[model samples]
Target: MIESTFPILEVADMQRALAFYRDALGGVVVYSYPPDGEGEPVYVSLSTGATSMGIGLTESPLPPGNVMLWFYVDDVDRVTTHLTGHGANVIEGPVDQPWGERTALITDPFGTRLHLAAAISAPPDEE
Candidate 1:
């Protein structure tokens, strides 16, 4: 039996998204396709350790942000700083939640809201 394939956020500016994902989120470019045999790429891929994603340019319309695509990272500060440096707007802070997680919101180039999250510190062990 075959499961269905998933979709990723394909942006018009693939290079910008690639840079943000790699430089900011610490994702590695695992795969890329050249543009008409030229060195330049028309499509790109990035992986956060194990999870992989795709990026490409398309004229299709994109809808608003959905909660399902949120990616939780280990380093919130680094991620926030990197995204902001590359022109992303931080919609919300690295605020601590009562449920024990530090979270933040960022607006991507395509107006997609990305939720950045990290687990809170654990309590010290008893003696």
Candidate 2:
């Protein structure tokens, strides 16, 4: 058997990263460890209820312009409004695509582009 986990992002600051993940993206930190003797994380992880990922502050800096993470939501308008209210920058739309979803792209303070997608609700079939 095999199992896979989502990737971790190396950050310059742990708390800042945590804020973006938790606040802007609505994720919760499922596991975290305080700094070791060297004052660095032993381990830390976050989740968006179903998906789990890690964070390592010491690994390396995130690339200059890579959209490394994406988040899909049930309501793009509400989520994007909340994120924008929280100071996230809206980069793209609440535009409907031919693929059948309304999507909006935004960038966090840490420069991660988060894609908010909401599938159009289907109407009930009439007899």
RMSD of each: 4.3, 4.3
Q: Candidate 1: TM-score?
A: 0.75
lDDT per residue for candidate 1 within 36-121, as digits (tens), equals 46776667776766577777766665565463346788877777877888777889978887777788898876677888888887
Off by over 4 Å in 2: 35-43, 59-61, 121-127
CA lDDT scores, all candidates in order: 0.73, 0.74
lDDT per residue as tens, model 2, 4-122? 85877767777777777776677877777773355656457878867887877865666635645667788899889888876678999688876677889887766777788877755
Measured with C-alpha atoms, the lDDT of residue 69 in candidate 2 is 64
